[model samples]
Target: MPPAKLKVGLVQQAVSDNDKATNWNKSAEQVAKLAAEGCECILLQELHSTLYFCQQEDTDAFDLAEPIPGPATEFFGELAEKHNIVLVTSLFEKRGSGLYHNTAVVFDRSREIAGKYRKMHIPDDPGFYEKFYFTPGDTGFTPIQTSIGKLGVLVCWDQWYPEAARLMAMAGADLLFYPTAIGWDVNDTDEERARQHGAWETIQRAHAVANSLPVIVANRTGFEPSPNPADPGIQFWGQSFITGAQGEILAKADADGETTLSVELDMSRTENVKRIWPYFRDRRIDAYDDLTKRWRD
Candidate 1:
């Protein structure tokens, strides 16, 4: 028999500068709300402890990075156990002095550290200076195994990479989750802002259709100032959502609101879709060596 359906929860919230306590409390409240609504799994936005602080290369931001099993994990572990739900969290991981990574840590239903995936792609765009703070991830493409099924998780920038999604599907992931932090530069016109957000959501939906796995993305919302005086600040667009195996939007939150959304995910649909589409059966792996290179040369 196939695994039973699981109700997934996503939290979309705003953040303030360097306020871990506030963020934790807010997140805890959302967790409880979602659990009350029957969410079996919960996901939060990227670097959720602080406002998307990477907008500048401030030395002070390093203080936000913590060890994997450190304070936040311990707290979240307890919450997971209390709710009896799987928890997916994004954090700033302090690997060593001057070394850190953007990571996703999963707490299983039993409230144990089930698995983790370090973000492989670090974007260095304007108003988003992530490369300045995060050391590129060493963890390769892999999924976190839970009582429900394997979870294919990647960070914000990693969401744009189809190869990453494919590897997770090839590795037998039952679902895909992208804990994200992305938004519009306040300087952009309204039209540009709309287009950017649309593109971001559209691409992830494509991944769901191609890989035949449910996709969950939780994003932070609200305006965070640029740590650098020279750069314009960013308005983090929320719109956190969950998509089914067919890439259909299951639930989507407001672009600027604090919301807890839960959607029922049919675990069996993965195999059902794959059998009908057969994308995996026709492997072009033998002819895909160019994908490994920096570029076609």
Candidate 2:
């Protein structure tokens, strides 16, 4: 059985250019601190080892991809064992010679590899050309079982889709964790930027209420200039946060700074919330076949 309460930690940090060692060391220190603070599970932001290389479609960026159990896994695995805490991290996965994926790996406290979730949704917007790098995940909406509980791990793009969260909830996920890398275009108006950020957070919070599961999001911070001089680069708006099953904000980080957020999640709250607002019980599964279609037409 899962514990009644789980203390989770989020590492919201900035990334510099090509400084993998520094990034890893800094995040490791943060993880150690969170562990000392009694965090049972620690989640790092997306692509924590390096900068968000997907800002442009440069073919050379493929060099950033590495194997799943490669250097990163070994590094974080040792930390998990040393700190005795479940660790969640996102990685640029090199599946094979010409295949890659945006992947999330979960490590049990014993330092063993528990499971992984390849990011299902791959966004290809301007200043965010992920489809050029990652192949859509073959791994379905299966929650990873851990000592703390079953974790519904998703990537940045997947967080926007209600279907992803619903599938995980139906599969018995105890909580939803999104290791994310999203931000502003640097050229957008202040009002547009606020709207984008608000939508990003509001949608995730709605997922928590809809699934009756606590939601945890860890996002990168700071400005990473574009490799191409003509481009305006991305200004990553941090604001990493944790929300309760009732869609209430539990903890939140600053928008432009690096910080660690730790919050105690009451696992039993899911049961109580579901009982009062039983959306699952009222789901019209039989009448939802049209959902699979591209459009009503």
State the C-alpha lDDT per candidate. Answer: 0.88, 0.93
Candidate 1 regions exceeding 4 Å error are: none
**Which tens-of-lDDT digit does each residue in 48-142 have in candidate 1?**
88878788778988888999789888888888999998899988999888899998899986658999999999999887889999988888888
Task: Give residue 122's lDDT in candidate 2 (0 to 100).
Answer: 93
Model 1: lowest-lDDT 10 consecutive positions: 1-10
| lDDT per residue as tens, model 2, 189-223 | 99999999999999999999999999999999999
Ten-residue stretch with the least lDDT total in model 2: 14-23
Give the per-residue Cα lDDT of candidate 1 at 272.
87
TM-score of 2: 0.99
Cα lDDT over the full model 2:
0.93
